[model samples]
Target: MARVHAPRLIPDPCSSAAPRRPLGNDDAAAALGPHPGWARLPLVVLATMATVIASQSVISGAFSAARQAERLGYLPHMTVRHTGQHEEGQIYIPSVNWALFIGVLVLLVVFRSSERLAIAYGLGVTGTFLLTTTLFLVYAHIKLRWPLWRLIALGTVLYVVEGLFFAANTVKLFHGGWLPLAIAGIMGASMLTWRKGRRIVMAYQSDVEGPLTDFIRRARNGHLNEVPGTAVYLHPNTVPTPLALSENARFNRVIHEKVFIVRTVPANVPHVAPQDTVTVDRTGADSDHITQLTLHYGFLDDPDVPAGPRIARDHGVDIDPDTARYFVSELTLLDAGRYRGMRKPFTLLFMAMSHNAAVPADYYRLPRERTVMIGAQLEL
Candidate 1:
């Protein structure tokens, strides 16, 4: 309200001058010259504190969003630490924190001053604003059931304003504005590549491995060497049996007495209750030895492959969690330049990422001694 009425509320000395001079720093200091030290010092401190608070909020928001993205399969998983037991949202990601710290330090060193940094800052802020507006427009139309005319009208108004702001920022493209665009472009490309690469890999695996029901039936009829104790296989698709299981039976010529197929699906919710997280479905009534376990995890929930047996036990499926052996499919991509659609550079990048991704044993919380990785080479 003070700012809205400032022109009328504050006395304007320029009103008395025939040709008014622009207000300078000296004029502002002169205006504040009457304030005592106590008042001035506190005001300056308050402004600094407010700036710090705002920056902290933005930093925290970025961390939270990154973690959520990891859960939704948009990014790789990083270590997450809960800062407070009572506060579920109070979490810290060490990697993101350090990256942000280093990025800010580099920015400060390069820009040297806030005036120079403002050119880059506006691009980041306005770019994010436009993206959020675009996403929300779709969300409102589809999820919120907004009318078509209302959507078009609101979208046009917002796009015009934000478009102009973005265009204005483009004027500073060579003057540090390119930094945010470059960063955004790289990150966006990497994420899209990862998503596409994963889908392609899954599709390839599905083609290689047939349906789970058929595999189970064949194994039962073949009278494969039955090994003692339960064995759990983590599969990408619930319908298709993992190559790991087929490979184990083919090469090793042995199968566990009780085979559990565990497939995890990430839910849209934040956190699913532990009790309702696992749902067990038997592969067939005739085949009591094999069961299909579907694990539903929230975007924030950790997927524990080792927990499948325990969850099965709780639900009256006969199995011991401690003695179960976990089999995980480890793909070795052979880049023969056979893949299409995804560029070769991105395919190579995705391959590098897959090689560096967290090992299934550690990620799934499986016992190091008991967990076995079945490797298969696939040409791409």
Candidate 2:
């Protein structure tokens, strides 16, 4: 009690001050200045990472792992998956582990190739990075309403940083980088070819509906031509309309010649044997040329499936859809400015090769022919 009283009377050091806690929000903001900027930055970094990973997934999903590894000299050709007896494209594809596995194996077996792998994959990543920068600049202006000057400054800085990576990746070109570059080229061209082919198909469909339908009606009725034994309407993908057959009947102007609307779609599953099909009657077979309607299927999924009669027959629509007399109305561009870029100047020249290469057949499952070439140029 005495001690307590003494304490009560005794000194308080500077008004009973207590130990201060650790520096937190205010300290950090003071240290960083403009605190929310820190939070915003993590979001931006996360978005960028998502884009890069997604890009890798798309590219890897399309190509095999071993073949992709080959670009950087990871494995010998013998180890790669080869195309089966009937397949056309490259065979050895990649999975997620193949990417890292090869890179690791390369480091263990042959140190030099591993370094090249690092450099080679870097280009694909950097190429996309540059694309991201370019696209994001356009996006920021629209999304954030950033002023022109700020956008330019930010864009310029991004370009410089990303450009450094691009330049660094280019160093690999001398050491087997060209192989991946060529693969990239093939992928880009394939995409363009599919687009051009679709354009022609749409144009042909437009003419088929009205005036073309009328012409067919007269012909079928015998004002213009006699009835053929079979009118097979061929389409590259699944779901061909009996339009061609419909037109044929319209020209005939009488039902009784059977009509066959056949489609050759490609399936995604690899285990699926080449010959797969679904047959159906379009509008209950309004007395057209179709003895049987067979929908052919290709090995690759429908989208990647090329327009070819051979691929079509894999699914069982093995009929001759194109003849010397049969017209394939086609419209394509040698220079469709749609797929434009600095890294892709070759696009301008390659589009010509793609357009001029004899028109691909609407897939219907047969040994495809390469002769028919009908080129149509639409209004620019």
Which candidate leads in lDDT?
1
lDDT of 1 by residue, 1-380 (tens): 45564454555666764557689978998988865767888898999999999888978987888777777676665667678878767888877788788888988898898888899999889998899999999999889999999999999999999999999999999999988988788778877888888888888888778787787777778757887888888886788878999888878888888888888888889888878888887787645488888888776666876675677688787888888888898888889997756889999988876775666776777899998899688888
- Summing lDDT over every window of 10 consecutive residues in candidate 2, give the lowest-scoring window: 70-79
Give the total clashing residue pairs for model 1.
0
Candidate 1 stretches with Cα past 4 Å from truth are 1-55, 334-341
What is candidate 2's local distance difference test score? 0.49
> What's the lDDT for residue 30 in model 1?
97
lDDT of each: 0.82, 0.49
Per-residue lDDT of candidate 2, residues 1-380 (tens digit) = 45544435545545656445589868987987765657798999999999789756655554654333323223221222445667645454433346556545654564365465666667878887888788888988998888999998988898999899889878778775564576677656544544554454455555544443453344446654444433444443333333444443444454434334444443444434434445454343243233334444334422212233334445554344453122232445444455533124545444444443322343212224522233444322
Worst 10 residues of 1 by lDDT: 1-10
Strongest candidate by TM-score: 1
Listed per candidate, the RMSD to the true structure in angstroms reads 9.4, 19.0
